[model samples]
Target: MSTTERPRILVVGGGYVGLYAARRILKKMRYGEATVTVVDPRSYMTYQPFLPEAAAGSISPRHVVVPLRRVLPKAEVLTGRVTTINQDRKVATIAPLVGEAYELPFDYLVIAMGAVSRTFPIPGLAENGIGMKGVEEAIGLRNHVLEQLDKADSTTDEDVRRKALTFVFVGGGFAGAETIGEVEDMARDAAKYYNNVKREDMRFLLVDVADKILPEVGPKLGAYGKEHLEGRGVEVYLKTGMDSCVDGHVVLNNGLEVDSNTIVWTAGVKPNPALSRFGLPLGPRGHVDTGTTLQVQGTDYIWAAGDNAQVPDLVGRKNGNENAWCPPNAQHALRQAKILGDNVVSGMRGFPQKEYSHANKGAVAGLGLHKGVAMIVMGKMKIKLKGRLAWYMHRAYHGMAMPTFNRKIRVFADWTLAMFLKREVVSLGAMENPREEFYEAAKPAPAPAAPAGAGDKPKAKAS
Candidate 1:
């Protein structure tokens, strides 16, 4: 919250776009030009591309997240969610993690609220389906997977062992494919420590509605990725969808059924549902409608970008397509943030806004350790790579793009050390309920405080 004297720039998110956009605005603006207040439910920004590696135990969860306060010392960081925005009054109501909701006025607003995991009303999904959206989920997935291995090793019953060893993954996009690949790799190594559990005993199945996996990396590479995973003994079910996963019982549309203790859902993501309350022009898919300039369709004071905003794909449109939109990814989010930041500053200073347009720079996907697919699209020439080389390309590209020199160093260090040291496949599943053990062992209530002074010295009352 800033005084009315200085123009206040209220950023509604602190994720990729919000953090970078605020940084850009602060960097471009002079001292006291404006007060930037960023409000987010989290105190840190999660670099999602590293989430798969984090889940696979290849990277530490904390290293993948950048502390918002440390990076934006100049900006007022609020640990809260913006409930609604009254653009008519230029005020946004915020609900902190632990407090009442309040309104904050702003001159320029940044709608970088980001997206949430897209899910359906599938039976038992809400209860059993895991997601890969954040560091917490990644950590939980790692622990749960390892814990399952433990159960499988210790259990004598064949049914119990089978359930513990079976893992089902929905969606064959980057997240789903990468997660299963890394997890299967980790499990293979982890199985060596168990007497009963072996890599051959564990079952890894990937279900996707799409005809191919890693489509963003091109067909040849995608096919290579599928074949490579299959070579590693992973069951790839393309053009297949999961029907129901009731109580850990997975039934696929293709008539395959299995009992899996771990089922990861990474089908897709949708913009924040709270966007509806913001009173902005939204696209058909519930994203903020923004032009190539990244400005809201009918508002000059409010700007939107990233997964939450439907920004026109200027490069794609320029080439040929009449209806083109920027896909939600880190590449565009980062670039869009910088340009959106400059435009916000320009708007404040009465200057013309600069349009944002960046061409697609291909895509990269790492399958497990030493396995991946990369497609480099340079105009007419499309260079493709697979296997170890592609894996290195994926690491190199994302390692440099992880945000902040501090985080980049930490991530690279994690990778460098992983090469020399064996991967730790320990399970800390108790982390989810750290207090459960204590609660169970804790003494019961002290007999309702012993009836107050009933057991005290009766003679003391006489005194």
Candidate 2:
């Protein structure tokens, strides 16, 4: 096909929305009708919900990600980031991992560049706090937590042992609560193998500035989750903020001070600030403004979804809410992706686009092993569950929601094996710096002081 005849669809970001939307659009388009190109910093899209399980060794870290190239074999997958978008010229400047940036012209664009961890100016947060945004962070947290356990067990100093054993998590949202719970469970199980360490010797503290936790599951379930976490010996501090966490020394606004080796920051996320440079209209919170149809406001060829777009909430609007927008979560992202894909195809064909609308079904959260909380919405009734039943529901929902069938089967297999076997409590901290020993071994030996006399003779021979 001639370049002039072929239409190009450039997708910026190979994340949840970008991957699914591109796949849908490719499946619907006829051969040689349009070219689909996906650009992202990473080559794979991470399944974030399973991160906690991965951290706890319930699932493999590699299994929680889908390779964009393998999944979108028919489309061109570019491992780069679109640094700038010139809507007027219909061109984008892609900055690849290597080499220089280049301009890529496109007939249409999809901005699915997802959000980043929202952090504050808290002291030492940048240096000490570990985030839970990706699979790497989850794996790192697991190894770090286990290494801390080893340190505590081997140390004779009471203060050092206490600091190593103390785990502080800041954030009560799904990421914060679930991660702390999973890691704490792993730490407890790991302690069983250590003679010097016990579960009771470790201190797990969860702090949130909000008055309650898991607000998505409603008040009753949120309260239950807080109670359940507290019952597990986790110090739950609500309506309290951290003033400083410099050098692992955490000082809370509630007059509580502790020295902890592990500090996890999962407080919240902000939309990708790169959108500001894209020349698109962004919301007050720095998200792309979109209508119910998931189309960028005041634009015909550009569309957006996922955590980056502030799409209107049809369910809330129907309920007489004036200011209602969809929350940044996996539930809306998955659904909005399908709708956005359909709308893009229809717009390309000069057909009317469908409005993106859906009421939230419910929410589920696993609190490690056989403990959890779930709220299911059936018709107008709300069904709440806890304990083992809730945990199963959480697994079932996420297992099916996990991208492709291959991933679903793999995740299910991980769970199936876990049922018959015990969780792996071993820490492969060396995985992070696997080349350390190799680098040491590979170092060149110093020249045997080319005997000062040997160097002088070599210089005379050269002369």
For each candidate in the order shown, give its overall lDDT on alpha carbons: 0.93, 0.92
- Model 1 RMSD in Å is 4.7
- In angstroms, give how far residue 264 of model 2 lies from its true place: 0.5
On the 0 to 100 scale, the lDDT of residue 182 in model 1 is 94
Candidate 2 global CA lDDT score: 0.92
- Candidate 2: how many backbone clashes? 0
TM-score, predicted candidate 1 vs. hidden true structure: 0.95
**Per model, how many backbone clashes are there?**
0, 0
lDDT for each residue of candidate 1 in 36-61, tens digit (9 for 90 to 100):
99999999999999999999899999
Task: Give the runs in model 2 whose Cα sits over 4 Å from its true position.
Answer: 1-5, 446-463
For residue 381, what is the lDDT in candidate 1? 88
Model 1 is weakest, by summed lDDT over 10 consecutive residues, at 443-452
Cα TM-score of candidate 2: 0.95
